[model samples]
Target: MLIAQVTDIHLGFDPDNPAEFNRKRLDQVLRHLNEIRPRPDMLLVTGDIVDRGDAESYRRLSVALGQVNFPVWPCLGNHDQRENFAKWFPEIPFVDGFCQYEVEAGPLRLLVLDTLDEGRHGGAFCEVRAAWLNARLAEQTDRPTVIVMHHPPVEVGIEWMNTDPAEPWVDVFRQCIKGKSQIISVICGHLHRAITCQWEGTTIAICPSTAPQVALDLTPIDAEAPDNRSMIIADPPAFALHWWNGSQLVTHFDNADEHVMLAKFDKGMQPLVRSLMKERPGAE
Candidate 1:
């Protein structure tokens, strides 16, 4: 299964302008996904769908998403308003007022969790959400599963954007799937940058944002000190492709901009490609 992901699409950043930058970035990524061979089975929009949780923005988002040819599953992010999201995306059902659900793909299962704690810039996985996840995990013990959410429980070293390891919700989330081998990976998007780490026995892959990316600065930051370091940059819009090769999920990241091809499967490169292919055990 090939799954495409785009996140942190802070659409409606400029409410007055019809042609917002975020929307264009999102469209570019979507168009690329559509044009790619072996089209993605689905697209996961991992939250921060809009700048402000407004009905108009959600409505506009609905229109923007129509460009995609694949199915889309969106989770709640810190900047999202559940009610407004429901109003526009009535197709995405909510369970007991939370945007949490389970999707059964051909050979894999997707458990979508809601971590949007309104009024706070961080994530939250309350008892109710934890219970929901635990129950779902209990239902299927053999199938490979992927947890999709907006806020990643693991800290990615971006001080201002990191998820504190000591957070209570992180503990609760950890306990729910600490030893569940069924979970192949946890896919997330929040930091506006691509990150991967092994957390609680599973891999967590953070997809890059379709909007501007967060600057990659690992320097320690002091809130009181005014260091004018770059926090965000207008890098090319990016997306992640998760390839499930029957046994494991492999993730690849790339920007929407077309790359200048340095090599192709032409006569000039045929021998190189053949030589590489012949390296395999069974290759003739």
Candidate 2:
């Protein structure tokens, strides 16, 4: 099973201009996904699908996503407006008036969670959403599952972008699936950078955004600290691919930009490749 992710598209960043930068970035990534061999079995667009959460933006989102050949699943992000989003994605399932659902794909049970706390910039796993998740996890015990969401529960060290670990909702979310060993990983977005770590005994992976990315800064910053540094970068658009090779799940990050190929497996490199490959411990 293969799962690809693109996030924080923020379409309509330039509401009046059709030639918006984010739109181009999204198109580049979509074009790349369409051309990949054995393309992803499913694509996960993990939140902030548009900027204002308006009807027009969602309409544009639908049109762009219509070109994708694989099954595309989207979850709610902080910037998303439930009512407006529902107008375009009326087919999306809702539980307790929140965007939440489950999907099964090739031995993987994906539990898509809704962490959107409308009118706020951070995330929340409120009581209602958490209850729905608890039920979903209880439904299937033996299946390998993955949790998909927008804002990652863990702090990624970007001060302004980080969610406090002590938040009440964060603790409540942890209690729901703390010891559920069936969960293989938690795939998320919103940070706009590729980050991987272990939390609650499962791998937590954050996919990079299709639009500009959050600058990587690990230093401590407080309210009194200076704030003149750049926050967003014009780096190449990227996505994450989760590959399940039977026993375990592995993730890979890739950018959509095309760069000149400086090397290839031509005749000169063939012998070296053969020699290295044959030397593997599992080689027969």
Candidate 3:
């Protein structure tokens, strides 16, 4: 199964504007996905669909997402308002103050977790959310499962971007994921950059933002001090593709504007091309 992951759109940020930078970036992503040779089975918008918790923001978000041909599953981020998100996406099921849902595609089971602790930059699962996650994990022990959330459960070595007050909630999240061999990978967003980590014996991947990217700075500095330092890069919108090959999950980061097919095929590539043609049948 192929899943396209886009995150941190921050739509409706400019309420009065006809075109917002973030919304344009999102459109580019959608157009790129639609133009792909083989489209993804589903699209996962990790979170931060809107910058503020406003009704108009949610409405704009709904309209933007409506352009996609594939199914989209969204989670809430810190900047998101749960009530507004619910108002926009009434089809999604929420339980115990979490927007949690389960999707079964072939042999893969995707578990979407809501870690948005409204009005905060970090995240929390709480006791109820943990119990719900545990129950979900238990129910699908035999199936290969992938967990998707807005905030990553593990710190990615960047001190400032690390989860603030990362004590109790991080520990709780860790304990819930431990000893779960069936969880092939954990996908997340919210840092606004692409990152990977290992926590509780599972692979954790953080997708890049569809808007401007966060600059990669590992230095510890004052959070409030305006040192003329920023972690945002004005680069093209990016996303991640998670491929479930029935046994393991492999993730590839795609920069849509930077894709180029190199013409460097070697003699050894002929056999592989023949094999692919045989498998595809119709390919010449």
lDDT of 2: 0.92
Please, what are the lDDT tens digits per residue for candidate 2 over residues 153-241? 89889988998999888898899889999999999999999999999999999999999999998877777877778789999999999
Measured against the true structure, the TM-scores of the candidates, in listed sequence, are 0.99, 0.97, 0.90
Best-matching candidate per lDDT: 1
Q: Rank the candidates by lDDT, best first.
A: 1, 2, 3
| Models sorted by TM-score, best on top | 1, 2, 3
- Return whichever of 1 and 3 wins on lDDT: 1
- Candidate 1: which pairs clash? none
- Candidate 1 C-alpha lDDT tens digits along 62-115: 998998898999999999999999999999979878999988777999999999
Index of the highest-TM-score prediction: 1
**Which regions of candidate 1 are displaced past 4 Å?**
none
**Candidate 2, after superposition: displacement of residue 193 in Å?**
0.8
Which of candidates 1 and 3 reaches a greater TM-score? 1
Task: Provide C-alpha RMSD values for all models, in order.
Answer: 0.7, 1.3, 3.6
